[model samples]
Target: MPLRLGAFVHRRIIAPGALASATLLLAIPASAASYSPGAPGIGDPYYPAYGNGGYDVSHYDLRLKYQPATDELEGTATLLARTTQDLSRFNLDFVLDVGEVRVNGAEAAFRASGEHELEITPRTPLPKGTAVTVVVRYRAVPSTKQAYGFTGWHRTPDGGIGANEPEAAWWWFPSNDHPLDKATYDVSVAVPDGTQAISNGTLQSTVSRLGWTRYNWRSNKPQATYLATLAVGKFDITTGRTDSGVPVINAYSKDLGDNYGAARASVERTGEIADWLSGYFGKYPYNALGGYVPNTTTGYALETQTRPFYSPRQFANGSNVSVVVHELAHQWYGDLVSVAGWKDIWINEGFARYAQWLWSEHEGEGTAQELADHVYASHPADDAFWTVKPGDPGPDNQFHLAVYDRGALALQALRNEVGDDAFFALLKGWPRKYAYGNASVAAFRAYAEEVSGRPLAAFFDTWLFQPSKPGVSAARGASISTRDPGTKGAPGRPESWKKIAATNGVHEHPER
Candidate 1:
């Protein structure tokens, strides 16, 4: 199983003031634009060739056929995108053996160059902002790869689950395989008659023909390629809807035996947690709420887009429900507001981990402050948690203890520094502001500073950048010292939902 990667970005809001009435802009000349190949990568320092440049994909309609007996897959990925540059050629990240490539319905010249770059040459040069459809046909056995400390995909007993985090989308299909390029999805998978198939989003319709059953899933909300999942197995599925009416679907295999009972109980609790998170973190960010193929093989649970993947080990505490809370919280923090680069993964893992702590506090296990303090005190100066700070942990060191546990500590530290009013304002504001977009650590630092109206450079540096544990005196307070003690206690006191809902200067989605 793949470990959870992270989410969210903080954008600095600058009031226009007197300049609001002015309208001034610059225009580009036609001659300045020329046809050239789009870059092979999006310039991410960690994985430079991860996602292609030059186009913004709006939607992907994937028609796929899979045979469980033979472990073979045939797929046609139709990508609808608008070119951001004049291009005679462009690249897409694809690792499979391709049968054909078509640009705008015509067979185009293409080749699989290097390990993951698929160079495609169109019949004509595509102009800037030109809407074009790129269709790729391929047939191969679905495979998983391990890179960047994350497993690209986890093969299950029946079929497989897509766990591509940093760079694994190409292993299963052709894609602009990075979080920076998010697109809506329409996935239709054809499987044997009895075996069920699951993917992201709402199940639109199911058609049975001959010996195959086609499951059509539609994701209207924009989603990063890594967050996309495909689950095929013989399982028991239950369906319902959250109180707010978001559809809920849960699937689990029968191999778990008695563990299946606990899995069912956890699935039943998903709606209640979703409702709570929607209220705490803004409206649920996607069209559906679900978990797919909860088996024991996948060691880790992933916050896959509309549906999260779970392992029996994750629910070991039976109805503990922390893992469910963590993944559901990600729909807002990770799925809605994604990380701009892999390095800023703390934004995703940190937010989800903090939500887990919030769940614990809500359940009376302990307040977030107590949990944060416990973890912070347990780590010695020479511990691995302090060796790689969450902000700049190298590519191979992601999903370490620091990324999840210490990352939560950083958030609690910030909450303590800026009181509950500003902290909770940021919780709702950050996701709403960067909804359906990519964000970076720099953006987060600036956003936190702006929202709290405090200089937090040193705070972030000490908690997220430094490689040594900070001083901790349990009697004085939590690990990080608060410069301003302005009439607010630590983050755990019960507050009226009405007061949290009354937050001012907080940016919210217009629809909300």
Candidate 2:
């Protein structure tokens, strides 16, 4: 029995108590759309919550004709999805940062209790092995800045960083925000004449109509909704391959973040980093890899599945090359081996930073002093560092030292205590062992010890969990191959890691 609630798109017929807050751009997904196991909860077992059972959204074949006239998103989005668990419900988020929305054939409710949500619930129950179709029709002005109107300097005459995207992807459309819930996607972005539109994965087709442009993209692997992105601007396109021979296409917009040279570096070096990772670790975790560097205001990069979003300014003129390495590392560490919650951010940031270290050492420090200095400076050394344990990288430490410096140091110490062969062997196996899913910090630590054939408890306890950097004990029969200690254990001179250190926020040398 389906209860009919004749609520307008902006207002709900259901009691305000029963209907979640209908925020502008966000709302319900999965559980309410189809038959659900029961009423959904606040968080799911794997992904961010619309509070329901498995909302299997693995494959998408978006079929639509779109036009961006009058600055509105006018089109149809046909979605096909399956669930991991049974008993009926499915849900997802869509930016709907536009004017209107609808689902299937009915007037699906746009129930966003907060920002960036649209809920669609069907009247009947469907059994397992059943797939559902969702079609949305809508229009609105795409925000020039990031989603939700993040303020910035006014646009330059040419519309540079002055008009930047303040926030990340979830602003565009909705799906599960976290990576544990994967969705294979087919996206078609249509823009104005002479403008280019890009999304994740391969470009299947691009057609220009009377007055608008359309580009369709499809992703074969499962992906989180947050990483799903769309870019519409005047862009320069380049197609290339990674070092190990995986093909990729990169899009750079004129005066966007970076220009031709930066795009070239990303196309060239990001693949090389992938090869380095595969050589030390194992196969590239993803089936495909590429990126979209929109004309954006973000200072850092978002490692969105196979395709990451980079700010052109970082790579232009060869400035932030290691960022390419760090973000590419996230393809495996963040996108593929996702952390279960925001708390476990280190699993994403730490490993990526470690990749930068590996690249630094491989390239040669040009001198012993240079290499030693590079590693020491990267340690999160203040008493504050002690407070920001590996598990809890303090409020200030989350994206900063604990995750970046402490995380990198953790790997360096492990490599020192164990050997490079054993250390890298563990990293290579990590993604293969826990591909496209979540794992706790404890699980990772144990895996390292098991693979190394040594007890890493001291290394882990003293660094990963301990509040302070406990004094290093004697080797205790463990073979220690550290770079070098100088001036009574004080951190010595810095050099070699100019590329890596640059990305970590240090622009100067470490005091000896």
Candidate with the greatest lDDT versus the true structure: 1
Worst 10 residues of 2 by lDDT: 1-10
Candidate 1 regions exceeding 4 Å error are 1-33, 144-151, 294-296, 316-320, 472-512
Off by over 4 Å in 2: 1-54, 61-71, 82-91, 95-107, 125-130, 142-169, 256-263, 316-318, 366-382, 394-397, 474-493, 505-512
Residue-wise lDDT of candidate 2 within 1-512, one digit each (tens)?
01111212233365566545544223655334433442233253322333234455455554433333433444555566553444333444444443333433544444443344455545444545556565655543344423233432222212222111112333334444444455678877766677777677778878887776778887766665555666666667777787677877776667654365756655556666788877765788665677666665455566766777676556655756677778788888877777655556778888887777666667664332234334444343455655677665543355655567667666666776778788778888888888766776777888998999988776777767777654435222222223335435544444445556557641111210
Residue 296's lDDT within candidate 2 is 55
TM-score of 2: 0.75
Error of 2 at 42 (Å): 5.9
RMSD of 2: 9.6
* Alpha carbon lDDT at 147, candidate 2: 27
Once model 1 is optimally superposed onto the true structure by TM-score, how far is the C-alpha of residue 293 displaced, in angstroms? Answer: 2.7
| Per-model TM values vs. the true structure | 0.84, 0.75
In candidate 2 the C-alpha lDDT for residue 309 amounts to: 67
